[model samples]
Target: MDEQIITGATAAEITASVRTLHERGALRPGDALPPVRELAALLGVNRNTAVAAYRLLAQAGVVVARGRAGTVIAGHEAVAQEGYAPDSVLRDIGTGNPDPRLIPDPTTALARATGRPVLYGEPVIDPALEDRALAWVRDDLPGRDLRITVTSGAVDAVERLLAQALLRDDAVALEDPCFLASIHTVRLGGYRAVPVPVDSEGMTVDGLRAALDDGVRAIICTPRAQNPTGATLSPRRAADLRALLAEHPYVLVIEDDHFSMLSQRPYETLIGPEHRRFALVRSVSKFLGPDMCLAIAATDPETAERLALRLSPGTTWVSHLLQRLVLAQLTDGTVLHAIAAAGRHYAERNAAFAAHLTERGLPTEAEDGLNLWVALPVAAKTVAERLVLRGWLARTGDEFVLSERSAPSHHLRLTVHDLTDEETARLIDDLAESTR
Candidate 1:
């Protein structure tokens, strides 16, 4: 609270001073920061200098602007993450993972993946993998003259693409009910997230218009198997979005087709033929197993060059062995058949579960992707609590929503495809009773 404690002449210096203060316990969470004008006067600096300092602190999440209340220190908030609880005994049905049984065995492919050692100056992409990947993604892409770059996974690709193109505090359009990793990525990068609501047909046009109007520098889209909601972008909806995006041709568009291999729905691209500045990322995690962390990024020439800057030879390039393995499995007839069967298995299980809910007077639909989005008669939180008592752990739809106005979601995203018939029946009965 001492005016004497705050001392700095420049924005970066002021930010560092505040950080040191916080580290020393002088500026605790919820403590109000000095007003910009007052701080400028005290520190004998220009008003813009103080404003820039505050902006830096806000972007780092050390302080939050509270309108009339002014700015206050922000304590760490709980971030939603993927996978299961570390020590929970509850049967987790909300993990949102692919069924392990369906993932093809990698033993044979691993053995064949090894070859002569790649030197530091060799091309980053394996020649065979690059060739196969190009053919694989070419048909679905609307844009031409695309270049490919590989990354660890979809999350890594997105982070690099955004970092290359955006500055801290730049606005980015993200789906309201979004993928957990995507949400975390934007927040950690200090980017302002503009919420774009998603419907059964994928990201709504109105929501996107609002984000664009807000001046978002970049937009992240999921073309199919949109997480948490299992919504696929219809051809008509994709056309509509392309028309809207056509005007803003320079805004960086990053489309993550994370479930491309397993999606039952047709790929509908938002990128128009003439539109520039875009990247399409496809990860092998869903079908090839999550441990094999490799993804292919196809982008415009300029974007590709920007992204390449982050990847240094031998230091940051994706593992050549892993890339070869993925390509081999992808081209194998047996692996292809297994992937197809796995897709059907997920679809059938979700449909069966939806049918059960319909029979119980709670209508639900089996959409594409590994999970089923079910609407509950009561609050999803209440149902989840009841399910917890009945030995089930469920993910509430609220966790995926980006807007506070969309809180207290009544829907629950359930991944019951891997459950046995007995377990499925038990979950259905428990869900019905919980809703009541």
Candidate 2:
């Protein structure tokens, strides 16, 4: 036991040992390691040596110091193991992820721009990016008084908007079974979330009316491709919502057009001109790669000014390098081509799966965006568990539901874009079997 310690007394050696433990699966994500005092005593080293080693590991992303929760492994074993698959046996059908093949390679453009040193106080959002983004957003958000602010992502934009608009304990209306991120964001900010119902035509006007009646100060609505459901708001529904919102003119309406570029459905503007406060956030992460992390937030001058105040140049301005990269791809015609191909691919694949389910006597239909929302005869979690047993990972509808005491629906959000025909058919068959 005395001879088991690695001979080197240096801090670098201790850090290397900790990293080796993580690399070899001896440490795993969320697993708390020995305390600094305990490790120091065991290794016959000073407490400072152990502290420095842990800090080095944290910097390298090998471990995280969780304060009272203690230091723990940061990366999962699956991440460390090359090609290690999760328990999901079926091909990945759960995640609402874009096809990696469609993301155009940015390395070529990034390399060309690597020659310059990005200095502080320099323009954060690239001028070229601003020009192109403004033009692109204007296509969907047509109005004379709109101003744009660049953000890290759609989620980032939403968070900042909430920060600027609401104080702690304020109520924000969100679609019931909302996108999980929205739920987490609102909760983390200590705001109350008022649930609004979503139907085939997207968020219901009556639900919004109820939320407003309940005194919600803000509302986040997805006009098309409502996550986990793939429901697009019909024109009639949008008009109805606009009419309802007219009664409550002061409520802030945030229309998240996350699927703007990839959606095959017709665009419907829910934030009517009469509505005094609104912001339309469109993110490129769905159509482009998530690594780009760029979104354009358009609002009226007043709201824009408030949002802009939160985005001071000193704090968090969108990175110029990232902005330039997005601008290069967006303007090159290559990104548009890729988006067209991806949209077609998604539509065809989703249609094929829906057809297979229909043939099996299950009701199914194809919709826009990268994934399909399928209804099953059982609870979504049960269906998801069965799918996992069959080697496929799927997202349960409950994860997106924001309502309380509502009967759980048997719905699974499937990413069918990259599945082969045979694989798609097999999945349908397995799903049929699983439901039974």
Best by lDDT: 1
**Alpha-carbon TM-score of each model against the true structure:** 0.94, 0.77
TM-score of 1: 0.94
The C-alpha lDDT values of all candidates are 0.91, 0.77
TM-score of 2: 0.77
Give a tens-digit lDDT track for model 2, residues 1-436: 1223322366799878767766776656787877888778878889998888877776566676655778877643221111113664457776677888887778766754443656667655666666776786676666547788899999899998888888765789998768877887776665668999888898888888888888999999888888767788999999888888888877888888898878888888778867778888989888777777989888878888888777767578887767777777777676688887777777777888888888997888887677788888889888877877888777767667666656886788777778876887788888999888
Candidate 1 colliding pairs: none
C-alpha lDDT of residue 350 in model 2: 83
Locate the minimum summed-lDDT window of 10 residues in model 2: 76-85
**Candidate 2 collision pairs:** 89-391, 90-391, 90-392, 176-402, 177-400, 177-401, 177-402
The residue-by-residue lDDT of candidate 1 on 193-282, one tens digit each, is 889999999999999999999999899999989998899999999999999999999999999999988989999988988888999999
The candidate that achieves the highest TM-score relative to the unseen native structure: 1
